[model samples]
Target: MSDMTAMELDEASGQAPRPLRERLSLGPFSDEWTAADWIVGSASVLLAIASAGFFGWSFVVSMKSPDYFQQAALANMPPKLDRIETGSIDVANAMPVPQIVRLSEPTPADYQIVMVFNNEALLATRNELMRVKVGSIVPGLGLVRTIDTEAGSPTVVAENATLHGAPATR
Candidate 1:
C-alpha cells in the first residue's frame, strides 16, 4: 500500500517468484542437495510423473474402448434375437454365436427349440452342449404311486446358461 507494487513488496520480503524454474528448493534453502533431499525430490517427481502416466493411459483406454456400451439400454429388454428358430434340432452347430438366442425358454408341446450361433469369433464353442432331463408332471407324470415321478422327460439344463470367452491376441 505504500507506493510499492505487489511484485515490489514480494521482492522486498524475499518472497518473489522467478523460482521453481530450475533446481530443487525449500524454505530458505537453494542449491544444496543432500542424500535426503535427493531422495525426497526424486520420489516426489517420480510419483507425479507416474500419476500423470496412469491418468493419460486411462483416458486413452476409455476413448478406445468398444462403442458397444452405448447400446447398454438394450440389455434391459429381452435381447432382440438375430435369429429365433423353433425346432428340435440345434442349429447353432452350423453357425457361430458371439451373440445367441436363448432356446431354453418354455414351449407349448407343439414346438421344440433350436439355437443358432453365427458370430465368427466364438464359433468354436458352438457345440459345447449340456442337456438336463426332467421328469414330466412331477405331480401326475411320475410312476403309478400316490407320488408321481418321471412320467415324461424334461431337462435340468433349461435353467442353466453357458459362458464362453472368444479368443484374443496381444
Candidate 2:
C-alpha cells in the first residue's frame, strides 16, 4: 500500500489547509436568528414602547391635578402692604392710576404690582395686616389693600399701585 501525499488528498477533496464547511457564518438564518425569533423580538419592543407611553400619561395627569399634587399656600399670602410695598412712582394718572410696586418679604425686595383699579383707593393704617387670596379682585381687577393700627397714630393713603395679577377693589 502506498502512503498518499497531503497535497494529493487536498486536491481530490477540492480543499486546501482549511476545511470547506468550517467558516463562521454571520448571515440571517445561518444558524443565527430565525424569522420567528425576529418576529418575537419586534413584538417585545412594541410592548416596551406601549408600557412607557402609558406610564408617562399617568405621571402627567397626576402632576396637573391639585388633589394629587397638593397645592402649596402662596408665599406672599396674608398680604402685607410692606410685603408688596411701592418703591418709586414713575407714572400716575387719574384714570386707572398706575404705580410701581415691590415685594419686601424674606429680604431683598422685588418690583411687582399693587395696582389701584377703577379709582379705588388703598388706605393703610399702622400695625394692621391684610390678607389677599385667589378671589380678590376689584371692578377693574388686580387691586388690594389692608391696614391696622396698634399705637394711637395711623395713616391711610392711596399712592397708585400696580400689581402683577388681577386687582381687587376697595
Candidate 3:
C-alpha cells in the first residue's frame, strides 16, 4: 500500500486542490478584483439605492396628493355620461311631435275572451267546512262573478270558492 496523503492522491490524479478562499471567491476569472470591477459594483449599488429613494419619494408624493385615489378610481371606472350636446336652446324646435298612424277604423274584436277565476287563496285556508271542492256549495257574500258580452261562453267554471260565514254589519 502507498503511504500518500489526500493532497498527494489528488496531485497523483492530475487535480490540484484549491484553497477554501479561492474556491469560495465570487469572480471566476481572478482571486483579486480590479479597480474597474470595484467601481462598477459601487456604482451599481449606488444606482439601486438612488432608484429605491426615487420610487419611495414618488409614492409619498402620490399618496399626499388630494385627488390621487379619486383619479385612480375614475380611471378604472366606466364613463357615466356618454355624449353631451353642444348647443341646445330651442326646446319647441328640438321636441318632436308624435304622428299617429291609423291603418284602418277600429273594428270589434272577433276573438272569444275566456274568464279566469283565481281560487288559490281559498285553497290555502285550512278549514274543512270553509274549504271548497269541485261540487262543494259556496255561500255568495264576497264572491263576485262578472258577466261580459266580450267573454265568449256563459259556461260556469268553478274551482275552489271562498265561503264567508257571516256578513259584516257596520
lDDT of 2 by residue, 1-71 (tens): 14866556666789775443334455545567778987998999999999999999879978788455343
| Backbone clashes (count) for model 2 | 18
lDDT of each: 0.41, 0.44, 0.47
- The most accurate candidate by lDDT is 3
Estimate TM-scores for all models.
0.25, 0.23, 0.24
Q: After superposition, which runs of candidate 3 have C-alpha atoms over 4 Å from their true positions? A: 1-16, 27-33, 66-170
Clashes of each: 14, 18, 0
- lDDT of model 1 at position 39: 94
* lDDT (tens digit, per residue) of candidate 1 on 1-170: 68986557668889754544332355455466778988999999999999999989867866887554455646767844454453345566766648745555422231222322221111112333322123222111221112111223211222222222222223
Task: For residue 90, give model 1's deviation from the true position in Å.
Answer: 32
Model 3 lDDT vs. the true structure?
A: 0.47
> What value does the lDDT take at residue 54 in candidate 1?
95
Ranking of predictions according to lDDT: 3, 2, 1
Residue 37, model 3: lDDT of 84
Model with the higher lDDT, candidate 1 or 2: 2
Backbone collision tally, model 1: 14
Instruction: Report how far off residue 65 is in candidate 3 (Å).
Output: 3.0
